[model samples]
Target: MARKTIITCAVTGNLTTRDQHPGLPATPEEIAQACLDAADAGAAIAHIHVRDPETAKPSMDIGLYERVVELIREKNTDLILNLTTGPGGRFVPSDEDPAVAGPGTTIMPPEKRVEHVARIRPEICTLDFNTMNSGAQVVINTPRNVKIMAEIIRDNGVKPELELFDTGDIVMANDFLAAGHVEGPAMCSLVTGVKYGLPCTPDAMAMASRMLLAGTEWTGFGIGRFAFPMLVQSWLLGGHVRIGMEDTVYLGKGQLTAGNGELTARAREFIERLGGEIATTGEARQMLGLAQ
Candidate 1:
């Protein structure tokens, strides 16, 4: 039997804007419908990041999360929900006073970062372990902050999807596991193609995968143009896969996807053409040890 692969669709990430893809789901209703449509298109899990309805900017608002979760559960209870805790980590230093935070700085207390996860209680929530330079700003996920967020997510009975951007992040994850901050053999994702982090290359991914703890349930993905290629690379490396507008707006060369569903369908086609089978929601739940 072909191994079953779990496809996670990340709809409307924090940075992906309407300018990049006009069809990006911004409102709660649109985000919920995007997840439902992706689930129908062969994605067993939806990696989510809510945005403000008016500004379309990423938000840590609990009400927005509640509405999105409520909407998704109303239609499809089987699809796994993986919310993100990555929005409140960027730090842009002021030009006049480098010691002070700039206009783009969004660093907040770790507890506040996972507040939505604790309340909404999704099946999974991403715990980013990278603290690297991102564009003009830096994303700061200190070990201390990561531990605090991990404790909160664990207490909520939500699995932390470890987001590893480099080898050092993987090392941090292993330490977190050993220290009991996160559960053993946790679910993780390798984020490549980001500048100053992991590069989108076969050898780079292979080396990172080798550094993970044994039996870790990991999915490797890339950003922008590297998305589809890394999806295949991830499967070839014996890991699961992820795709959606959050990862890329284009389905093919210069061809923008209609929505999350189209990106998911293309990912499913790639997996099937590689002679792998996409897991159903139930099977994905069982594989991840999530309650059925």
Candidate 2:
């Protein structure tokens, strides 16, 4: 039998904007519909991030997340939800006083960062282990803070998808696992193509995959132009795959995808063409050890 590969669609990320893709899902209704459509197009998992309806900016609002979840559950209960706990970690220092936070700073208490995940209790939530320069601001996920968030997510029966941005982050993840901060045989994602982080190259991704602890179920993906290529690379590496507007706006060069469903369909086609089978929701759930 051909290997079954799980595809996760990230509808709207915290960083992707409406200006970048006018069809981006901002409202709760739109976001829910996006997930449903992606599921219809062969995505077994929907990786999510909420945004303000009016401003279209990223939000930590529990109400928005609730609405999105409610809408998704109303139509499709089988699709696995993987919410993000990656917000509230960026720190932009002020020019006037480098010691003080700047306008873009969003650092908050670790507890607050996972508040939505605790309440929603999705099947999975991302736990970032990277603390590095991201654009003008620095994303800070200290070891102590990551541990606190991990405990909260585990307590709520949600799996943490360790988001590793660089080599050091992978080292941190191994340390966390050894210390019992995170469960062994973990679910992880290697995020490449981000400036100052892991470079989006075949060797780079292969090295990172080898560094992961044995039996770790991981997915390797890239941002922007590297998305599709790395998706294929990850599959070749015997890992799962991910795609959607959150990862890229274009389905092809100079052509924007209609929505999450289109991006997911494209990813499915790629996997099928390579002689791999896309897993159904139930199959994916079982593969991840998620409750049926």
Candidate 3:
């Protein structure tokens, strides 16, 4: 039998991608619909992030998350929900008073950050493993903050999908594992193509994959133009893959994607062509060790 590859669709990220690509899902209704489409297209898990309905910017509102989750569950009760706890961590310091937050900053306490996950109780919630300079903005998720967020998710019975942008992040993740903050067989999302993190190279990805502890469940995501290529790379390496408008807006170069479903379909096709089997939702649930 061929290896089973799991496809995870990132419905909408907290980035300002809507302006860059109008196809990006903005409203809760649109996000839920996109997730449904992706699930129908063969995505076992849907990674979600809500945006401000009016401004189309990242939002930390629990109501938005509630609506998104309810809509997906109403449509497909078995769709795995992987809600994001990564927003509300951007920090752009003020010029005049460095300690004060600047215009782009939306920094909040760790408790406030995971408040939505605690309320919605998604099957899995992302726990960012490192803080790095993402372009001009600083993404801050301090060690203290990580511990607090991990404890909250662990206590709530929510699996933490550790987001590692670099090798050091994986080291930090191992720390959490050692402390028992996260369950055994740690789950990591190897984030590539971000500024100041690991470059979107096959060698880089392979190196990061090697860093993951044995028996750890992991997935790889490639941002922007590298998304599809990385999808193939990850699957070939016996790891899972993640794709969607959150990571890449184009189905092909210069061709805007219709939605997450298009990306999901292409990924499923690629996996099949590569002689890999696509895992169904039930199989993926068992693979990830998630609650039914």
Give the Cα lDDT of each candidate: 0.94, 0.94, 0.89
Candidate 3 lDDT over 101-138, as tens digits, reads: 99998888999999998888999899998799987889
Worst 10 residues of 1 by lDDT: 281-290
lDDT of the structure predicted as candidate 3: 0.89
lDDT preference between candidates 1 and 3, better one: 1
Measured by TM-score, how close is model 2 to the native structure?
0.99
Model 1 CA deviation exceeding 4 Å by range: none
Q: What is the lDDT of residue 154 in candidate 1?
A: 94
Q: Is candidate 2 or candidate 3 better by TM-score?
A: 2
Clashes of each: 0, 0, 0
TM-score for each prediction?
0.99, 0.99, 0.97
Q: Compared with the true structure, what per-residue lDDT tens digits does model 2 show for residues 14-55?
A: 999988988899999999999999999999999999999999
